[model samples]
Target: MLPGHADFALPAPAAPVRLNGRRPIPEVPQMNGHSEAPSANEVPPANEAPQPTRSEKPAEPIDVWDQRVAGALAFLRRRLAGNYEVDDFGFDPELTDALFHPMLRVLYRDWFRTEVFGVEHVPVDGGALIVGNHSGTLALDALMLSTAIRDQTRAERHLRLLGADLVFRMPFVSELARKSGATVACNPDAERLMSQGELVGVFPEGFKGIGKPFADRYKLQRFGRGGFVSAALRTGTPIVPVAIVGAEEIYPILADIKPLARLLGVPYFPITPTFPWLGPLGLVPLPSKWLMRFCPPIPTAHLTEHADDPMVVYNLADQVRETIQATLLELLEKRPDPFGL
Candidate 1:
């Protein structure tokens, strides 16, 4: 202090110490407009609170394989413990939900962009018959309908499909179909399923509906012998007529190859625009907009032995067909285009 000058003689200020290992802030001196080097002794007020800086964190990625593995393990555990549920017809509920349904949902919800209407019309409890238009060269309509019932309804009903003889004729496919809740199409099976208070799904149009040329799309084919109607009546189950649109366009059958079909020993060899020409790629379905509407339940409790009468069954079947046909026409009018709607 004495070395500088007599005017500079004064006690020096105490040095500031760091807090929480942080260096003390410095105040710069003014030179020109900007301040010069700051003093190291400039400390903040002790009474003030320190503010924390805001930081954003990136989201962690999801491991799809992990989820799939975990789900598989869980499914395995359920099966080993005899916790899995399957009907008398070998309809493995656990297997269908845990495995097959996920793959089919990709087609139902994502590819087709399916929209379900009048899901409320399907009974949540007791036995009921679901009759819908069947089409699409691959019978994808049935799968889509099954998905709708499984996903939309509160009860999450499993649709017991009545498959044709050809469906069970395939080796591995027959086993797969049975596990997916499908049984042979017959009066005895339908009656038995309904008696157990199960929801039965029937495609009355049979091969005609699915194998028919795309030009006949949305046209109601003849309901076979009203046998499904008789089944519903026998079990005193209500009939739920469902109208399906957009299945016809998935694979447009331009023509039928009679010679090839006869050789194949199949119902009909469909000549769709892309099939056989595109090879395996032709099997891919067009992402057509799908619309499924469920009409109100037509109660059969009022009708007596009338269900046994051929004429009564015919009239009832016609009524159901007409109703579905009218509804389909209305729905078509509402839809502007097949792909977009």
Candidate 2:
């Protein structure tokens, strides 16, 4: 302390120490030595020999075609369970011959030939509500639409379609619908599916489209009070407007059976050229050329808080209707056949 400043007071030492040996001692475990004492980190060369490595086996060769086949088979097994076996609906020759055979041929051969636009509009993984015009006698349009999505996009997202009450009541029809992945037209079921990121097909027209008089073919009936629009608004999903052509010409209903409908507990009774009197043969839908156009997705991301507003719902519904109507007009004028390229 005197070397720096005589006035400065010096701090006391932490602890008293005493010298033990002439040389400073080492602070570590004892090490075996043959020749001389070694400094820290002075490991022997033998101890530093490189470790042996296991040889990795060659990676198995891949078969891309095998993967595709397996994928298609697994997909068929899951979706078309009863389809292969005899379903709850007795042996459906018509469905087997007419629908499935054609579908398989398309899937294996021509399905890829069709062109699709605005696929990006569809969410890669979410519940999307697709509101479309129902046509082609029965909901054959729905079946093809589902098939188209699956075949084209490689999306296994089954369209949990909102089917009519009549479908469930019928013994055969109900089972087929269940196997083909369709459910009733209700909000609970729809929301549950959409929440799971599934695609849902809704024909808001319902009986109106199927039962619309022959004179009014292709003229879209009034879409119910923004019900589907509300569904989208509630779920906050993009609405895809699907316009279907060629369904109109199939079994055109020239007349209605209001009396028969009331008695049979069904909507308008169809008076086609060959139904009821024609018996089972009448059920065969006329092979009208079909075209399904999935228009651009309408964004719901922008509405902010007004998504729940009734006026918003109404406007959205009108926009969808107008879009479909315009698309239908364009399709009718341009396309040569019902099932256009």
Candidate maximizing lDDT: 1
> Residue 21 error for model 1, in Å?
58
Clashes of each: 2, 4
User: What lDDT score goes with residue 54 in model 2?
Assistant: 16
Model 1: pairs clashing at backbone N, Cα or C within 3 Å: 27-38, 29-36
For candidate 2, the 10 contiguous residues with the lowest summed lDDT are: 13-22
TM-score of 1: 0.78
Span of ten consecutive residues with least summed lDDT in model 1: 19-28
User: What pairs collide in candidate 2?
Assistant: 126-197, 127-197, 136-247, 289-339
Candidate 2 per-residue lDDT over residues 172-265, each given as its tens digit: 7887776566777776666666666678888988888878887898899888877777767667777888777777876788788899889988
**At residue 278, what lDDT does model 2 achieve?**
89
Model 1, 150-226: lDDT tens per residue?
A: 87676989999999999999998899989999999999999999989999999999998998887788898899899
